[model samples]
Target: MIHLLYLLALLLCVAPLIPGLLGVVLPAASWLPPLGLNSPSAVAWQQLLSWPGLGESIALSLFTGLGSTLLALLFTFFILRRYWDTPQWRRLENTLSPMLALPHVAFAIGFALLFAPTGWFFRLLAASGLNTDNAINVVQDPYGIGLLIVLAIKETPFLLLMSIGVLQQLQVKRLLAVSTSLGCTHHESWHKVILPLWLPKMRLPLLAVAAYGLSVVDIALFLGPQRPSTFAIQVWHWFNEPDLQLLPRAAAGALLLLAITLSVLLGLRGLEWLLVRGTRAWQLNGPTASTYCGLVSTSHAVNGRYNGAGSPQTLHPALITRLRGCATALRRRIPLFAPFVLIPLLVIPTLLVWSFAQRWRFPDLLPSRYSFRFWEQELEPLLTLTGHSMLLALGSGLIALVLTIGCLEYKQRYHRAIPYWILAIPLVTPQLSLLFGIQVATYWVPGQHFGLWVFWSHLFFVFPYLYLSLEGAWRSYDVRLDQCSRSLGKTAWQTWWQVKRPIVQPAILMGLAVGISVSLAQYLPTQMLGAGRISTITTEAVALASGQDRRVMAIYGLLQGLLPLLFFGLAVFINRRTSRYSSPYSSQGHGPSDTSSTHSGSHHANDTVRG
Candidate 1:
């Protein structure tokens, strides 16, 4: 019976890949019956090759994807290594959850506002008497530096969050004490000992970041170079073109994008095994890594030499004043992190403002006038859309939760689950690229249910995150408690329901929240699979955001993101309730100490954990 349920669940969760992949592949290969191209040929591939700057586009993809990923890793590492175990670590850990909660679109939009030529900073520069003619033009620059920075900053908090578990699991105190006794500094301990273990655990999250960077369309569309967009954006434009016949070409591009994504993921895995885990030649042969740990010498060393700064006297009044100023600077710098968090704020307003203004045109800075007419007119139709969106989010989120629990249970019994590379398939590539082929393949299936296909697509995509979210909880769970319960005569199912479930309730809630948010924000899969018949809130927001209206766009954008945020907030509330003194189990007095909401990796959490 369990096998049947697992098979059904696996098929429901993973079967959509067939349609999605085949949908993209058939068109990509120029073998489509509907378009009257009955014969299969290499024409689509040829056409993809002939596009101008294809090489540069690939280079941009690789550079942006790899660059942003490596940069995020380095920055996250520095942040944790410098702060972990220090007085500031708690505050940093606390800040990561909220920062991570902000969505990518919201972050990209805010980044453009902060750094664009006519960005808010440019306005301030104009006020400061700086030459205003050329506002630095960082936004949408060909080099994609602006885009790279946005991705790096946006993902930093996520890496930090993922690191929390790995760091706690590896036991930082033992490593720290050993390294200190051996004459290694705190940073050195992190590099030589903690890192080798930490990097492997981080491999999954890092791959996720790499894949998102590789295939992201919305971010690339807004901030990446325009003349020759990233491969993902190029595929999106192909899909959007009025010429339906160009679908094959779009599919071809998507195939290529998927290829690149997989290749990079494999390369990242190989690189990690080689450098961090492969051999300890660098660990033994090379000098201690502490000097290299504090700051990536590459970014700092060059700057130091070029700038020729002076060393100040320590413990002197001037030095104390400078230290105090540095401390103040760090406090103020927290808001600089706000572009990732606050951009959604402005984008929401922009989306709302645009949705209602009839005469508002681009570059006008404001709508001529606003009306509630769009809201009044569209609200009736949007009710159906909202219902569909909720139904889809709920359906996918629940499936993801079940699948995650199943995987966890399987690991408990069998000591293994699916590999990370397989799990990351839906996450690290362009949905449009992969989904194009998948969409084409979907049509080839004997029948059609746009809603069913889309729900499965969401499940495939949301699974990795749900699993990622729950893995921590599953690991942190006190298995001995289960053993104790079993010894006390409870059956496996009963113990799971009454004890284990209640203990991991917070994680389960958070996983569901993550799943819902992921499904809610899905724009490409929902739009592509639904084939224009099914419009969700995300699809509506993206469609209306392209127009000249502001008031309406802002209102919709806010709601678009707000819906998921509302779910996330609810999940957190539930998690706190059920997991904190929040649950009836709170009388167990597990409160803050039993569960830090930060780290739960210790098998003997009572003895090994200090936080």
Candidate 2:
């Protein structure tokens, strides 16, 4: 049974990748028989490399991708190191879900509203008597700085969220206590102790960020440079060119883009190895090596905060003084999360204003006039598209959830799982590289079921994230409960249904929400597979963004953001309710065990009634 389920998962999740990749690979090799290029050759590669400004585009991609990834990593670690156990962390943690729930394309639109040359910032400058005519344009800056900054800001929240699971597993309080007791300052301890440990565990999330930075298309299309564009955008244009002869060049470009993405991923992994393994001298040197840094006093370094036991009996003057400084620094930098957290806050209102504005020209602090005309005009089409988007998201998310639970349960039963690298192929592989082949594969079917194709494509992409989200919970689940239920004469299905599901239902809900969000955010897959016939909210929004109708774009952006926010909000509410109901004292003042036995008794009663 487990073997069949494993095979089904692989078929659902990993099989599409083969055809998707081969679709591009064959054309890149000049073997597209349909195009009459029967003989394989390197002509396509030569043409791709010879394109004007190709080198500049590749350079821009590398700089933006690598730079944004490293910067976000630094910011995430700094924030975690300073405020992991501090009071400010609670506030920071609260904002992560909403910030994450906002889809990337909507965020890009909002970012442009704030930073464009004629955007809010420039308008503020104009109102303040500052010259606005010569202001720099960051939305599509030629150097890709705008794209880099936006990617870093958008990705930091995700990295921070991933770190939550890691830190919990690491037992951070004990680790900090042990390091500080060994004569290390907070600065020294995090850099020399925690960082090395954290980096190794954070490898996959970092790789995901880097991969995204390298291959992002929707955000790049909205905000990245236009003249040469990033490599991904360039490849995108080529793939969509009217002339079929140029398909090979596009295929070659996709392959090259894939190569670049893999290289960046490998480079990040190598950097991690160098820091954690290849060069260990810096980590193992000594606590006294950098103890006297301005962050920590000598007496504090010697006496330490507490012994390895993590108690707080002794408190010295130097320790007190340095601790105050650390707290102050933490408080100071804690506001850095504001701009990231505030983007959605500010952008939503700005979008709301724009959606209603009839004439809000540049340099105007507020809209000159407002009307409901845009909303009224778009209401019907908007409803239809939103319905399609929701249907796709719901169908794909639920299917992905079921498959993920099956795979994880199989792993639990067998104590073996698919390798992370294999699972991550759908994630780390550039969509441009695979989507072309997947698109072609859709052609061989007898009929064009655009909705079905889009649904399957969404399922393919959403499965990995849903599976990854549930993996930690599934692995950490205590199988003892399963055994106990079985020993009570329950079948495997009964044990899982009555015992295991209730305990991990919160995680399952969260995974479902995440998968839905992922499906909602998809732009390339919907466009490629839907073949311009189906219009989801994302497809409609991207098309409108190209036009100058800011009001319409804002409506779409807000709506695009609204669906995921609604689902995530639902997940949070359900999770809280589950926690309350599952609490030891929440069962009409009954104990936790009594509540469980009561649930079990009810389950048995229902089974007996059915029998």
Point out where model 2 deviates above 4 Å. Answer: 1-4, 288-290, 293-334, 583-611
What is the per-residue lDDT of model 1 for residues 1-611, given as tens digits with 9 covering 90 to 100?
34554565567656666666777777777889988989889988888899888988888888888899999988887777766766566555455554555566655554554455655556567667778685457678898888788888877777776666567668888878977787676766677777888898887678888988888776677578887877777878888889878777887888888889889989998988886866686565433654556556543442333323553322456755676798788876663335434543455454555556677442445568878887887787678878988999899989777877887787776686666656666766667776776777766677779888788888878887777667755765668978999999999999888887766666666567778878877888887888888888777756654543444545555566567667766865665455544334423423322232322111122211222
Candidate 1 TM-score over all chains jointly: 0.81
Model 1 misplaced stretches (Cα beyond 4 Å): 242-245, 277-279, 285-385, 410-420, 446-448, 475-494, 580-611
Candidate 1 backbone clash number: 31
Q: What does candidate 2's lDDT look like per residue over 359-427, in tens digits? A: 888789899999999999999999999899999999999988888787888888887777777878877
What's the count of clashing pairs in each model shown? 31, 0
Best by lDDT: 2
**TM-score (C-alpha, index-matched) for candidate 2:** 0.88
Local distance difference test scores for all models: 0.69, 0.79
